[model samples]
Target: MPRTQDFDTAEVVGRARDLFWDKGFEATSIPDLERVTGLNRSSLYNAFTSKRGLFDAAVHDYLDRVVRPRLRILTDEPTRPDAAVRYYRSLAGALASLPDETPGRGCLLLNSAAGFAAHDDTQRSVVDAYQRELSGALTHALRAHDPDASTATLAHRTRLLTSLSVSALLLSRVNRDEAVAVANTAVEQLEEWRRT
Candidate 1:
């Protein structure tokens, strides 16, 4: 008979997600995951197939637990676009506050995209899909608030704002003030779009 898995997969994935988020895909090693997940090398290999598999699982979990939930706050309450803006602003503020000693870790998906987009087809596809989903959520939220807005215009603006958010997260490492300023500008532009 096949051996039953001995650990909670979700718990393991959660730990892996944190490690990957902290160190990123390229920097994180199998030994690091094994240490973080409290799983032996053989068990991790048997369960996840490879480090990339575990990283993929961690990326999925992070999206489901962290990214999607944040997007949901906007999508679920589409009538309140300001809430979406405020939510994004708060994200920027939080990221800007992280200490310098911490490797300036950014969004795992975005970082993965920046570092691996050219070489890895899987990473590129995942990043593209994430952008599409976020843009769709923002577009849906914007339209819900202004039923008369043109679809093309709303889509363009949503893509622009989402790009700004991702850029803010990456840039916060170098210049917190500039990142916050960019976020503020995006918020202002969003506000102006609402009034139009």
Candidate 2:
């Protein structure tokens, strides 16, 4: 008979997610996973199949727990006309609030986009989906913010906002001030649109 699994899977994945966020997949090692997850190599392999498998699960957890929650303002039913503004300001707040070590970690998926996603098809697809989802949510909020905007104008604004948001997340790994500024720039743009 197969043995039942022990330990809290969610907690293990969350720990792994934080490790991966701090260090890219390539930099993360088996010992690192074992240390962070409190599961020996044998148990880790048996549970996740492989380190890559664990990383995949970690990515999923990141999206569900971290990414989606932050996006709630732009995604929840009856999205506010100011949802986009709120979202950008929140991004700025998060970046600005992070401790030195955490800001260097930046975003999990965004960091992966530049690292693993560059060569791995699955990783690329996942990152692309994130980009699409962010852009779509922003577009939805923009429409509510300006109900009479032309299709062309909507497309352009969405593109600009998406770039700014993505750039901020990417920059956080290297420069916290620049990252906060990038995010705040998005907030300024949204506020300007609202006022005009």
Clashes of each: 0, 0
TM match of model 1 to true structure? 0.88
Clashes in model 1: which pairs? none
Instruction: List model 2 lDDT by residue over 1-196, tens digit each.
Output: 9778889999999999999999999999999999999999988889999999999999999999988898889877787898999898999998898787655677798898888789999999999999998889888889988989999999999999999988998898889999999999998988898788
What lDDT does candidate 2 reach at residue 127? 91
Judge candidate 1 at residue 15 and give its lDDT: 97
lDDT of every model, 2 decimals: 0.81, 0.90
Name the weakest run of 10 consecutive residues (lDDT summed) in model 1.
77-86
> How well does each candidate superpose onto the true structure, as a TM-score?
0.88, 0.96
The clash number for model 1 is: 0
Candidate whose lDDT is highest: 2
Highest TM-score among the candidates is held by which one?
2
- For model 1, what is the alpha-carbon lDDT of residue 38? 96
- Identify the runs in model 2 with alpha carbons over 4 angstroms from their true place: none
